[model samples]
Target: MASITSSGLGSGLNVNDIISQLMEIESQPLTKLQDKAKEAQAKISAIGTLQGALSTFQGRVLSLSSASAYKSLKGSLADTTIGTVSTAVNAQAGSYSLAVTQLAQAHKLKSQSFSSVNAPVGTGSMTIQFGTYDDKGTSGNAADDTFEVNGDKGALTIEIDSTNNTLTGLRDAINAKKAGVTATIVNDGSGYRLLLSSSDSGKANSLKITTDDADGNDTDTAGLSRFSYDPLGTKNLTQTQAAQNAEFQLDGIAISKSSNTVTDVLQGVTLTLQKVSARDTNNAPVATSLNISRDTSGVKTAVEDFVKSYNEFVKSVEGLSFYNKDDNSAGLLNGDYVIRSMQSSIRSTLNQGLGSGSYYQSLGAVGVSFDDKGNMTLDSTKLQKALDTRPEDVASLFAVNGVTSDARVSYVSSTAATQVGSFGVSISSPATRGNFSGLAVANGPITIAEGDNDMLMVAVDGASSGQIKLSPGSYATPAALAAEIQSKINGDSRLKDANAAVTVSYNATSGKFEMSSNKYGAKSNVQITATGSATEATLGFKVAQGGTGSDVVGTINGEPAKGDGQVLTGSGKAEGLKLTITGDTAGEYGTIGFSRGFASKLDQTVTSMLSDNGLLRSRIDGLNRDLKNIGAQGNTVTRRLEDIEKRYRAQFTALDVQIATMNSTSTYLSQQLSMLNNLASGNKK
Candidate 1:
């Protein structure tokens, strides 16, 4: 008989079921490892939730850290019909009486009527220049005016050939050049006419068009010369409107600006003139009251938002680390050390004072404090009182600020590396501007004749100017000559492009003219590179170099500091602290008090906690590493369990085969014994 190979077939025993039961018992350790991995994954998710909460809180904290948040100002006008008023952060709180006498108007001119818009005009080169028209008598009468070209608004020359000789074609060609003048065509009752308007609105921005007409006569009212309008010579184009300034009165003081939008007259306020002020029965200008006040709404909203966010963040932390003692239930991050430490650090930073001698040194001084439950609480009444009394001090309590004792020493900025303390400021050398002093003139009332002493070339702050032409006239005084030279030098296109300018002054006692660069620092310098033939004889100006400017040299906190132009930066513990030195004296100016407020400090703290190398990140990384190890160990245990199951199946199969063999042998022996007994009985019978 063949031996039984199938399990449990030989001995009639269930070997497969027994092996399955044994393998189930062997997988206990692997199940425990899998459970632990799931726990770690839950903890990682919980940490991510906490990090999100911190990031949200950090965003709110940043809203109160900047200085601009506290510098907001509100402006209002009594007469809204006149204009609108806007205020900047630097605007001072005050009331001003304003009256707008005139609104600025751009210069507009129209050509003589033409039969058709497509009518052909003679080809020629037209030159356009912008300048001021000095009216010797009547304002609008061109016969009594003399025009002086503005070098800053450089002249633009346009060519008119057969391709662009028609009126419409000329408009297109001029528009393509963007020459600070807009050209348009309008149909009058008689015929079509071309209109030209100045881009700027001011007396100094009037237009002067001169032409080199191909029709032989450059000034006649024919061909391209018909467009020419030189107040001193030709007058073909009709002046529809005059370039006028915006005249206004502030607190009974006269003020005039080129544009309707005036900003420079006031420190940080912009007044947009709409229409002329209303006149009273006496024909006098009516006054409108402009009131500028502190805008506390933004600051108040920011404080409320910060408080709410902080309290919510505290609640989130408590919920994430919550534990139920009665039922022994715990959260995923119940015993997390990183979360506890981060919460403690943020709270500690908020409780610390800003600095010594500081107004509202801590957040509590501004009515913001942490409650017993770790939630931030704000007293609205106290906060309102603080804002009403010392709004700037309240701002300092929540933002990084610097205060200086001396008016000459102004705080510019500071960094996180700068410590909170009082630092002394001492200057070794004060900054100076570059200047050039010309030789004394032989006599007064100098004559600047054409083709003689009309041209001048100069370099300011390392930037060169083109040949500047002086108007041919007789200067009665040295001051008049200086003014003319300054205007021409500053108007040079090349110097203007390089943002370089010069201020010329006449030293009456020295009987000489002085020119100085408008820039500061070592790069500031002035030099007269070239001059006309009779320039030295008339104005005492020749090729000469001036003194170069120097940077401010200073020490901060008794240690060496860096100086660039007018800014002085500190070193050592006061590193990154910057101050603007405006005084000329070279001694100790004063001390600067620096402080980092609650929001600024807390913002940094929360940023660190959420960084890659922060405590939360480290803990998460460790947990991930543990999970990987657990997976590897689980894989090893799984392979061991498979081997154990294989062994158990082999042992059970062998035992079943042995039991089947024994039963087979017992059957064969019983048959043999029965046969022997029957044979013995037959022989006895």
Candidate 2:
């Protein structure tokens, strides 16, 4: 009999193909396992979605809790703030107090001087002299000379170096010592000549005619003892400042000034004085800080926002806890551990701990309720009752005790850092401040008031020349002298070298040199300082160099300005520059400008808020992409499972055919073998 080896398969596929088929079948189970895992992950993610909604609900319910506390206290739940205060109507005539803080002015006059009558000699003890230079004491060339007005013997001299020729020796020799007023040369069309004028302005703005060069009176040839005079001369005696300091007190704060107003002493505060009127009355305006504002709508908006958020959270929890009556009676969060955890978390939002204050302490006291569906409902009457009960306690709940984050919330808000401040430090906003101008005067180079570490230095450096120099003993008026000096400067080449020009500027309002201009841009800059004392006499000199004309403004200091007739604006004192700050710094109500300098950080912070978009949106988009991938994979798996089922069915059908044929063949063979055995048995018999 032929032996059937293990390789006896009726001509079908080999074991390798069957093994590959088996591997494909095994792969379907793994794919199904992976898909199931993805679904489980998606469900887990959906469960925690209520956390944000719960947080929002807590915030809103908190307001109701806050309002109840407010009502219980004496304060109203509707407290609010009004800013950039617009409606501050000016007080009528009988409505304010008027007081003159401080003022000093060079009252102008149209008057003449003492009509002169003096020969070359007289008998008064004092002698009046001229030809004073810009630097030295005196000189005696027709160009550099001296004359005297005698108050003693009434003697006068005109030594065009004629007296002992020692006069010429006097001026020529001392030109370089550089002691006092000396001759300065300027060449107009009429050859180079010298003029006598004070190096300063105002009353100290003068030429004190005397008979000396250094410390000598008629002793040597440099003295007026060897002088002469012009027969016809008169000078204008203008009203000018004797001292530069303007001082008084504001609410007794001891304000020292060099101009008409003080600025930025307090944030956004400016004080202007309109020269104390002779009949000061309550009708004239002054100010104090007792006034309060009335509108309170911001408080309402804040409470409403809180409530809306709280209600949304309550609704979320309710949805998760219940089942839908339709469609498989399914709850999306059914069997979710995260959903229960979030529901418990939301309950804690409105339950802030109470303090010892008298008003509403808990959200339960207000009309806030969560239904079986977890939707929050507002009970206005119950809310009102809580307000009537514990108002202070409610106020304490929402009155910004600690930060939520920095301004509002955070992880350890209960132990957050306390904000200590000397100035308004809004890191989220620009730190706003204004520049000061006019004259902030002090006592000396500095003053040493007893017991005080600080001193007062109130000399004004930014003053318009209040008076013209008048001393040659020959000019008809100070205006004439001013005209001559102005003419000489306008005609001189060296004036450009000196970077100085004397131009007459006029203001119809104040009638003075209250305006000036320079080479368009930065050439207009100048440094001004005062060198006199303040006391019971005439104010000292008001001198300005780079600025000229009655076009000069009544600035607080040399910082420059534009007076709105009431408030001064632009170019103030601080950081040591004559700045032209562009804004209404002295508006009655405070206004803020978005400056790039002061608010740079705020800009970056706002930019920072915008910056959060890229990162957060990226993360959200990544989640969306991940979700899409999961969904796409789930779809793929579902379709693949269907295809696999069909293919597996086809495979099983073919396998059944093969097995059926084998079984039939086996039966046929067995029958043939039995028939053969029977035939053999018969034949053998």
Candidate 3:
């Protein structure tokens, strides 16, 4: 019969206000939990910021840490119109005076004019060969100018039937074949003409097409034979351009090549002939001088970048570790040991000496220094002067060079080895290979044939093995026969795949034949078995017992070294020490100079810091753990606040009910007392 009453309704004591005040006091732990969560989240965000900055800084550091960074070379031509030059990091810095007398040209031929592109010339098979031609218009010797086509990909034949007898059809058919030559139809004002040209530049790649039509009338100029071009025979097609070699002079030395792009002529240099050199007043070729110089620009930019990156990184670190003066507040990462350790490690790497017998060992020696504010500064003038005077020394300042005591032995690794400084190399026994000795014979012709005289043998190397077969051939001399055998062994696909090779040689003075395996070690050996009448005695091969290969014996710094063929490697104190000793040396031959350049050390430091298990990652992991703990504390505080609020409401409700009951009791007592007083008064009257 009654509605639910409010907490303080009956008491009139403002129980709701009192409960609210008590609940406010109880929520203090929740506020602390919220503040702790915010702090943990802030720390996690700060770590993320640090990780990104460090990764970017590490990337910038890597830009200057490689050999390619320091070995940049720029090639410039005096007259770029004559030709353009390109260079690699390994290109030597020098001036090359080039006089391009002639540029390589491909052969081009045009057919006689026809009525239209759709006109049928007849159907036949066309054989396109390659050769060189002269510009004299007269047919030259075909044998001398003819180029032998490789059966695999060099030679190609196209069939022309009634479907592709037209000029346009022929062009499409040739294009689809992807032959070495391309055919196009040129429509002059009067009629159309079929033009054929070689796809490649060089005298050896000239095009010569021969046709055998269905009419069997090659002499007729109207049939498909009209496309036939034989310099020594029929010449239906007119030679518009003749194939020629590229002729040029480098530093006044005459050089001729089959192609315009000449790479083998110069070490680490590729000369591309664009046009013939212009002639001067005296009729002499005007040389286009190419100046190849070390590109110090990249090095300069790298140094500047290093300074900028280092300064920025240092600023970020200082900002995170700084104490706010206005609010008297410390930063999230203030006084962190990892930050201090990182700063120290970076500074040490920058300050350490190369110790590789270099004139300039430290960054300060090369014009790099840190100021009082901890900002990196570079002296441009000093850096440029050092680069110009002794550029190699400047390079060595940032890159380590593996120098050797003797020119015979040198270190190959620059960073793989952790053991720095010099290490000694000693050779005791020279490397040797397995072989079979042949009978002493004359230098005249030798007969190698199939059937009864066929030679067969097996090459062994670990689990990989293959057979050696010699075909029937007549070699004019014993050396020729040895060469034949060597070629056969090398041409075997299985042996080539297994890296097993044999070297055959014949000595005229000693009258001895030697067949030796190219690989050296106890794991490698050669066994010769007789096949047909080709026994060991007949072919001069010791089949029963073959020669055993031996590994090279050597020591690195008096410690036993491992040997594989001619290469000797060391471990432990002489780790990553590699050398090639083909013969025995009495004692210590040389010392391998091992030095960790500044860039290399910096690279290693940055890599370690940026790795997954790095200091930055570990710090982030710790921050994440704190955040998770803060989340749990927040939930616990929320639950505790809920329980406290419920208890406060129940206590205030009971107090209101008890106050209402006391009021009712007091009213009843007063009414009863009043009735008693009235009755006593009436009785007295």
- Give per-candidate clash totals: 0, 91, 0
lDDT of 3 by residue, 274-374 (tens): 88998999999999788888788988998899889988988888878888889999878888776887888888888887774455777887789889888
Report how far off residue 551 is in candidate 2 (Å).
52
RMSD of 2: 22.0
Sum up the clashes in candidate 3. 0
Candidate 2, superposed: residue stretches over 4 Å from native:
1-32, 44-48, 51-296, 317-322, 325-327, 364-366, 379-393, 399-685
Clashes of 2: 91
**TM-scores of the models, in the order given:** 0.87, 0.31, 0.72
Which residue pairs show collisions in model 1? none
Model 1, stretches more than 4 Å misplaced?
A: 1-6, 111-196, 208-233, 442-451, 470-493, 505-511, 584-588, 667-685
The lDDT-based order of candidates, best leading, equals 1, 3, 2
* Model 3 residue 234 distance off true place after TM-score fit, in angstroms: 19
